[model samples]
Target: MKFAAFSGVLIDHSIQEALQLTKKLGFDGIEIAAREPHLSAATSAPRVKEIRTVADGLGLDIPVIAGYMGGFSTASDKESEQAFSEFQRMLEMSETLGASMIRVGSGGPNAFLAEDYHYAKAAFWLRKCAAEARKHDKRIVLEIHNVSLVETVESGLRLLDLVGEDNVGLIHDAGNMYITDTDYGRDSVIALGRKMFHVHVKDEKRVAEAGSPGTFVNRTKHGEEKFLQCRLGEGEADHQPLFDALKETGYDGWVTLECHAPFPAYERLEHDFRKVKQMLGLA
Candidate 1:
């Protein structure tokens, strides 16, 4: 599998600078964060063209759009419609960015609806987006976040079934799965083997104290959050078995480096980049 990294981890720099850093760090691809304070997919076509040129110049293939966080659910029609519209906009940006897949979170507030209801609604939306994606020859990839309603493999599979399109796929995050209180990532690998489109490689180090209520207060405009982004191999995440499983399953997609590093952006990304490359034998 090829190596990729999230552009957000290198968010302290310009897109051109990020590309240079990624190339220097030995990543073969990139997952662009098309969100605020970064390159939003809703930007001008000329900007898209410039970014595309820079990516090509740096020899980085953008396999997916990473920060398209649109909340989707069946519990509310208005919310669902808004989500759908956001997705449509993201698809257009995906085309401009030369991204084959657009990644999204699997759960939200209305995620507690009945299984059938959730499945039907998810399927309906995916079908619509999948059609648009196909027009641009792209696919929709869903990242399985532990906090989401579709946290487990079974739920992810059910959602995939609901999506009901071959063009849809999965982006498995090892760190997220580890946090989810499950020992069955391999089981998920087996279940959604072929559907696996990309991988977000991160190792987690839990903060038991961080789980304490009101331990962190929201004083900033961005809201309160306290989880440290430790460098790879410095966390509690066990990626060895996960890597083994992916190898066994013959996964050939991009293994994107996700650095939630405790260090500064440059040092953290550089450190994690080298460490993951060595760990995955890409060195």
Candidate 2:
């Protein structure tokens, strides 16, 4: 598997700068954040080509363009259409960026206990996105994130079945899984099997305090629980087992590092890179 750095960590810098930093930190590729100050649907085609050229020159592969397309499951008919239109633009940008895949999400509002209608809506929109991505010879991967329709391996598999497209896949994010379902190890990875097209490497530990929360804690309206992002070995997310399981599945895809810690971007990147390399026996 190839190691990548998500540009979201370097949101303060331009995409070109993020690429340069990623290469300097010994990453094999970059997962471009499809957001402002980096890349977006509104970015000019010429600029997109320029970024692609820069990445190629630096020997950085643009494996995936990460985007946020939440709320489609709960959106109205008009809203769903608008969301699909926006994602089509994102697929076009992904092509221009020379990315092999685009990251999407299952609809939100934390529909972990919603009815089947909500899931059907999410599946419809995701299948539409997958179709658009397939036309561009790119894959659309849904991240296994919390507060989404698919947070666990079982739910993710169900969504994939619902989408029913060969181009659709999942991104196994251990940190998010750890937050939601703490059993994100070999079993989960094996469950995903070939459906996992990419991986997001992050580590989080739940804070037990009553009032104070750490900088990395992700607090939401659901509760005051804290999932503090920290160094790979320092957190509760045991990624080595997950890596082992992925290896067993022969998943030769991008394993992108997502730094949510409150530290310098370079520091977090370098630290995660070293740790992941060690885990993969490259160190």
Candidate 3:
């Protein structure tokens, strides 16, 4: 699998700068954060053309755009319509960015677990979006995250079933799975199989005393442990098994480097990039 740098991690840098550094660091591609302070829906047409030209010139692929269209779990009818309108614009942006997939989160408040959550409403919107994406020749991916509807493999599968769109898929984010399911990540990736259209790479250290009253803590089956974001190979997660599993599935795609370590942007990204190369034996 090829490795890419996620622009969100480079919050301190402009998109142009982020692209330059990603190429300099030996990443095969870049994942743009299609959100605030980066490139919102209101981003100008000229700016979109600029990013596309720069990425192409750098020989960098934008594999996916991490969009802000969280599912309509709790949005009002008007809000859902608004979100759909916004997604259409994002699809246009993603097309120009040369992204094959558009990443969508489970909208609304973060759920500690997948149970007792009414995902039908979310499914409705996902189905609509997935259908729309197909028309654009794009795929929609939902991240397996802590606060979202698809926190576990079972839950994620169920949601996909509900959406029932062929182009709809999941993003196996190992760090987020650890926080929500205490999963080492290999098993989940194996379970996802071809349904996993994309991935976000991160290694989170378990923090025993992270936040008060489980604000940021997940009452995982193991226990309530806070997951502290850290650079790859510098945290509790062992990515070798995860890498092995991805290859086993014949997944030859981009795995974006995304972490929330408190280190400087370039330092953390470079560190994770090297770690991924080492684990994959690319170095």
The best candidate by TM-score is: 2
Candidate 3, residues 10-47, lDDT tens digits: the string is 86788999999999988899999987566887998889
Best by lDDT: 2
lDDT (10s digit) by residue, model 2, range 1-283: 8889999999999888999999999888999888898887688889999998999999988989898764677888898887788788888887777788888767764546657887888898888788777778999888988777777788888888988999998999998888775468898888887898889998888776534333444433356466677878888888999888877778788899996776888998899989988887888
How many pairs in model 2 have backbone atoms within 3 A of each other, for residues 3 or more apart or on separate chains, i.e. clashes?
0
If the candidates were sorted by their TM-score against the true structure, best first, what order would they fall in?
Answer: 2, 3, 1
After superposition, which runs of candidate 2 have C-alpha atoms over 4 Å from their true positions? 210-224
CA-lDDT, candidates in order: 0.70, 0.83, 0.81
Among all windows of ten consecutive residues in candidate 3, which has the lowest summed lDDT?
Answer: 108-117
Question: Which residue pairs in candidate 1 collide?
Answer: 204-236, 229-260, 229-261
Candidate 1 lDDT over residue span 1-283, tens digit each: 8888788887878877888888887778888887655577456778777888898998889888875554555336686667667777777777767788887655542223335655666667767778877888888888876545566566677788878789888778776665564554567688777887878877665554464432222111223334434677887677777777877888888888877655676677678777766666767
Clash-forming residue pairs, model 2 = none
Ranking by lDDT: 2, 3, 1
Backbone clashes for every candidate come to 3, 0, 1
